[model samples]
Target chain A: MNQVIETILQHRSIRKFEDRPLSDEQIRTIVECAQAASTSSFIQAYSIIGVKNKETKRKLAELAGNQSYVEHNGHFFVFCADLHRHEIVGEMENVDLSSALESTEKFMVALIDTALAAQNAVIAAESMGLGVCYIGGLRNNLPEVCELLKVPKRVIPLFGIAVGYPAQNPDKKPRLPFHHVYHEETYQQDRSELENQLKQYNETISSYYKNRTNGERQDTWTRQMANMLSKQVRMYMKEFVESKGFNLK
Target chain B: MNQVIETILQHRSIRKFEDRPLSDEQIRTIVECAQAASTSSFIQAYSIIGVKNKETKRKLAELAGNQSYVEHNGHFFVFCADLHRHEIVGEMENVDLSSALESTEKFMVALIDTALAAQNAVIAAESMGLGVCYIGGLRNNLPEVCELLKVPKRVIPLFGIAVGYPAQNPDKKPRLPFHHVYHEETYQQDRSELENQLKQYNETISSYYKNRTNGERQDTWTRQMANMLSKQVRMYMKEFVESKGFNLK
Candidate 1:
């Protein structure tokens, strides 16, 4: 395997970080790499906010489900799906872009663009021998995050990512088997074959977690899904998205 | 700048690919890298189908608005927002996961997961000196693609990525100024500063495109947005998504 391929295959989310600040030059390079990612129709419908202030990081940590590592991570960035830039351009050109801003298509494009850019930043960070973890918990307090970030209308916070040198190396989590994921020329609903594969995956994941974190089996992947579903974790997202000026209609 | 940062800063889309085949080892490595990307709550709600058959590639090319590169790219992969795997798992455990599969949250998670993973694959490919281009045009004929690929319910084709050695070295496209994208502490609708920056960007993009394409002055980025909005490009997306079993209700 290629050296880069080996590096990629060994990737694991690093939640613990060394106590060192990223250089300004490194920050600039990573952000520039993010900006280099392709945007749909060149709208560049995303923005990233680098949070360097300690007080601000503490507040974001609270907002993102009290994740302590977020406060200590050497570099923290919030990626936003933004149409505000285009709206401003429209205003200057004396054209109406309200339809474009409100459309679901536009919202999807912005979200995808943000994800692409953020992923580029992650790869760049990793290549520089840095560790990174994405904090989807940021969405847990969407409204508050929006207020703190002073996000304008037509922009929504998608996720936060923390990047720095590693303090710990977590075990790589198991994925479902290839057959469960890679369908050939059509969608298959053959539950029997999938169940057979997933049973093995459940054991694989359960054992991996057990070995990594002592002998505490916190249920299988299925149980985790059920727990999340029963809790209705994402129930507020629709309202939150609307509040952020995205008209899902 | 670090070598990785340099690679990222110099990134450009390579639409034209050389007629070369990626080794099976390369394919496995890239896919494994993609699978390593973070998934929402570890649901891993995505999949990829590696397309190698020339006849299938021709049909996919037709589906993707006749992009000939789809047929010629050394490796073509379709990234999918997949919930069918979970649905099958549920069926085997005789567990009711219909609500999970039907939720808007699940659909968004799947889409985001797919994008993140695909981006990882792209980065891994680039690290190995391979070129990549994303084909958003895959959505143009969603139903046809679903039919052709035999994509099951709860598995929507998010996008296609064609990867291979570069046949053309396109210039890195300029992005909006940093200030236009990076908000400080909050969202501000301040346009005067951004508009000033955009004027320069417009000139840069115009000149770049003109020089690249035989004196044909394409409209500025702002004008491109205007032109796109005037059309009904995303007309079928809503219905297509609904048919894929996402209940946005």
Candidate 2:
């Protein structure tokens, strides 16, 4: 494989970091790489908040369920799905965009745009020999996160990226079998066939966990998913998003 | 910049593709790169559908508002936000995950996961000297598209990517001002300050359009946004997603 593909395939989430920060040039280049990603209709409905303040990082780390990596990375960037700017465009052009901006279609555009940019940022960081981890725990307390970040209406903070010099090189987690995640022309709907593939994958994952933890834990992917999904998470997300002036339609 | 970052920074949507198709190995490598992207809580809540059937592509092209690129690309892959597999995991574990699966939080996770993977695939294709375009026009008739693809419940066809050797190299569209999109510590909610930056960007974009189209289209970004958002597009999206057994909570 080529270097770019190699960088992508060698990816692993880095939770530990060295005691150093990225230079302003490095950060700018990373964001510039992000800006080059395709936006839905050039709406560019996203923003990156670079958290350099120690106090703010500390509070954010706490908000993200005490992830020390969130507080101690070379840089922490909060990627938000933002339509507040488009709202401004509506105002500047003397047009009403309330019906469109509040639609779920536009909401999906913002989310997808934010994610595409964030992934580009991740790849750029990795290519620069930096390590990164995505912090979905930011959703642990979305309203509080919005309050802490002073985010305005029509902007939802989706996730954060912790970028730094690597302090730990974790094993790359095995993904679903290639056949399981890919289909040809149409979706494969044979449950028995899919379950058989998952069954084999379950064995691989069980072995992975066993080896990773020195036999202390041997768990299947399905079991892990079941344990997590049996309980509702961020149950207020729908109402919270609506309250934040999104998806009100 | 490294080769990977260089590839990323040079990204532009390629709507015109040479008449060609990606080899099976090439397609596999692209999907592998996509699977390597970080997933929320390791959920990996997405799937890729590779369309090779001429009739299917032709129909999809029609469904996507007759975007010829969607029909004639070397390959068209539909990226989906998928919880159907998770629903299966729930069944095997004999646990009810309906509440969790249908939550808006889970919906966001699926969307984000799908987009991240799709972006990686884009980068991978670009690194291999191929060109790509994101076909958000697939959303024009999502219900019919889903039926055509035989998509199941809890799976959303978010968008399509058209990949191929480039037939044309378009100039990169300039993005919004860096300072306007990247904030420090907290979100800058000062509307006037934001508008001033956008006004400047409007000039840049206006010049770009004029230069690109030989003065045929000298439109500003805000004006374009105002024009698009004024018409309510895809207003059925919210009801459709709910009908697909997602975000029912």
Best by lDDT: 2
- Report the error of model 2 at residue A235, Å: 0.3
- Per TM-score, the best of the predicted structures is 2
lDDT (Cα, 0-100) at B137 in candidate 2: 95
Worst 10 residues of 2 chain A by lDDT: A240-249
- Candidate 1 per-residue lDDT over residues A1-249, each given as its tens digit: 555555566777889998898988778777888898877767788999888888988999998888888988888989998888778777766787676677666767787889889887887788788999999888888888888888878888888999999999777788777666665545455666677778888887788878877887656777676556545566677667776667455
Instruction: Provide the lDDT at B92 for model 1.
Output: 54
The local distance difference test score of each candidate is 0.79, 0.95
In angstroms, the error of model 1 at A241 is 1.7
Give the alpha carbon lDDT tens digit for every residue of B78-195 in model 1: 9888887777666555677777677656766776788888887887788788999888888888888888888878888878889999999888887877666766556555666678
